[model samples]
Each structure stands twice: as structure tokens, then as C-alpha cells.
Target: MNEAISLEAVSKVYGKGRGAVAALREVSVGLPEGGFTAIMGPSGSGKSTFLHCAAGLDRPSSGRVRLGGTDLAELSETKLTELRRERAGFVFQAFNLVSSLTVAQNITLPLRLAGKRADARRLAAIVERVGLTERTGHRPGQLSGGQQQRVAIARALIADPEVIFADEPTGALDTMTAREVLGLLRETVDALGQTIVMVTHDPVAASYADAVLFLADGRVVDTMTGPTAAGVADRMIRLGAWAK
Candidate 1:
């Protein structure tokens, strides 16, 4: 399968000289074009740093990050920003919706930001796909946590992006709501062939993915396929993630 994102010996450093801290250490991984991959690690394991670099939100201090065929290191800030806006989508734990905007507005915000118009048919389809068609006129403040996340997911899907990067997407939800959200994510992969790379700490959340990549001390330590919640929890235990 083709890779949606590829990292080759990528490393990120903060500060300089004696004060320099390495957040990522020659990390290399590739996300398949139509796969759902979860990233897990102990606290301070560079999960956020890895996500930032891979998503082109932050540049690697050394090595390369390729999003599809484009090398991120080769793009200027303006070009990179444009590329990210056009090709990638993001979801976060907080939902990150504009409080003043209605659900429809929030979902189409990315198109507006890119100076593109939203197709009425596409908008309706995406809204319906996320099971938020009835709530399109409601503002974020009026929606429940799960409903708000559905809005976020709809927003991510609006662009038909090559990859969606989610950071603790279900972190704030209750177990049942989280399952619903996870099911939606799974549907996107299986039904829409959407590629997703999610950074999560929850074992159950990780189990929703096609595969799980484990990180430790700024490096890839292991990987598990056909993961189960129980299995992931055990692996995290062995990695000493729970102790911290």
C-alpha cells in the first residue's frame, strides 16, 4: 500500500547547546494510505512531538517528513501552511469549534479558510455521515460533548483530506460516547478509505485502530496489529506507562 505519510530518521530538538532537549530521536514510520493507526506511549514519550512533525505543524530538526509525495522540509512556511490546509485535517480532544459558529459553519470552516466554496451536496453528505444533519444549525455551546465531536469529525471530513490527525479525540467523552465516536472513525476508514493517525493514551481507544505503534523514550519500541483493549493495556503496563 502507498504511504500517506512517511518519516525517515526524523528527529526534533528544542533549545540549543547544553540546554537542548531531544523530543524525538531518529523516529521512522509510515502510515498506510487507507489505514487507521494509533500511537501510544508513556508520558514524556514524544507522542505530541511526533504528531506535530508528521502533520507538518512542526518541522523536524533533522531528517525528512513526507506527506504523500511532498517533502515537508522542502516547503516554505507559506507553502507548507497551504499544503496542510488543502491536504490534511485535524481533530482534537477539545473539539476546537468556534463558539459563535453553527455546526454547518464550523464544518465548512476549512473550505472557507482555503478560499474554496462548499458544495451543498457534499456538505449534506458529510453532515449526514457524522449523524449531525439535524444539529447543523446549532452552535457548539448548544451541543453535548459527543455531538460536538461529531461536528469536529464532520469538519475534518469536509475537505476530503488524504489524512486526518487526531490527538486524544475521545479523551473528554464518556465510555459509550467514546465508543460511538470510535465507531465513526472506524467507519470512515472502512467505508470511505480514509487514512487516520491518532495519538491516544487510552487502550480502548487504541483498540479501534487497525494497528498500534508503541513509543518509548523518543523511539519506536514495538507495534501490535489486530489489537484488543486488554492486549494494549498489558503492553502499556510492560512499557511502564501506567507506573508514570
Candidate 2:
């Protein structure tokens, strides 16, 4: 398993001196290429912060984060932005599509910004894969919540990024919709060999990943493999996350 993401003794602190607040502390983890991983933690447990640092969306104050063998900490802001565009993809609970843009436009916007053209054939194939082929011309406001999320997923895949980072990808959906979206994410990893690192609090969501990392108080506290919703719940329970 070649490493796609590597973090070494990473620490992130907000503010300075006596007013400083430690957000992450000496955290480290390795994500195998072409693998799917889920991160779980209670609120303010550093799950989102860790994901941001690992994906180069945020920098750790004192540590190293590498994506696809390139040191993210060493890159300049422009270079870091380029690296993210070239090698990393991002998804969030909220569908951040432009209300006026059609599904096709939303999907190809990144390509247009990168000054690269989106191949018509490739765009059509991806649209079909996301079950949005028939809705390509519809604006985001005209789509269902589930369909909006599908568009987001398609947009993330359009760049053929080395890794996709999702923060609460299922947080805003209903149970059925969440399950459907989770299935799609898992399908992409299993069928497309997409490397995904998802930050989720739900055990059901964690079950979709090949592995799960549990964080607490800004540190990785445990990990589990062959993940099942039950197994993930037990780990969270042990961490007092599932209890009052």
C-alpha cells in the first residue's frame, strides 16, 4: 500500500502564548493509496482540522503533511493551491453549486478555471455515472437534495484527483438519502479505485470505509479495520462519544 497521505507529528495551535488554543497535537497517520478511510470524533475533536491539514486546505503550525509524496508544508500559497487543484478533490455536506449553473456547468467549472478544457466525452460519461445525464441542463435550484449531492460528487471526480476529502458528506441528508449517497461514495472507491478520506460522526458512514480513525482531544486515539457500523459504534462508545 503506497502512501497517498502522510502526516508526521503535526500540531495546530490557534493564537499564541497564554491565549493559545491547541487544536491538534502531534498527530500522525498514513492513508494508503486507492483506499477509503473515515475519521470519527465528537464535536471539536479535531477531525475536520486534521482532514484540512492533511489535504493542504489548512497548514499545521508545527508538523509536516505530505500528499502524493509532496510536502504540503513546504509549498507557497499559490503552489499549495495548485497542488490541491491538481492532486486533491473536496466535498462537503452542503452542496456548494452555483444556483444558476446547470449540472454540466457545475461539473466542468473546475476544469474551466484551471484553463484546461473538459473533454465532452469524459464529461458525458461522468454525468451518466452519477445518474445525472438526463438532468445536465437543469440548474441546481431545480434539482432534488439527493441530486444536488450527486452533482457535488460528480464535480469532485471531474478533475480525476488523486484523493477526495469529504467533510460530513452525508450530514445534511435524510436517512435514505444519506444511505444512497454513502453507497455512491463507497462504490466510487470500490469500483473506481478512488482514494477517499471522509470525516463523519455516524457509524453507518464509517462502515463504508476500508478503515476508520477515531480522534479525541485533538489526537488519534484508535483505529479499526474490517469496519462495520456496530464495530465503529463500539469504538465510539468506548471513547464516551456515544454516551451522555
In terms of lDDT, the best-performing candidate is 1
Give a tens-digit lDDT track for model 2, residues 19-59: 98888999988999889999998778899999999999889
Please give the lDDT score for candidate 2.
0.91
Clash counts per candidate, in order, are 0, 0
Number of the top TM-score candidate: 1
For model 1, the superposed segments whose C-alpha errors exceed 4 Å read 241-244
Q: TM-score for each prediction?
A: 0.98, 0.97
Candidate 1 all-Cα RMSD: 1.3
All models: lDDT?
0.95, 0.91
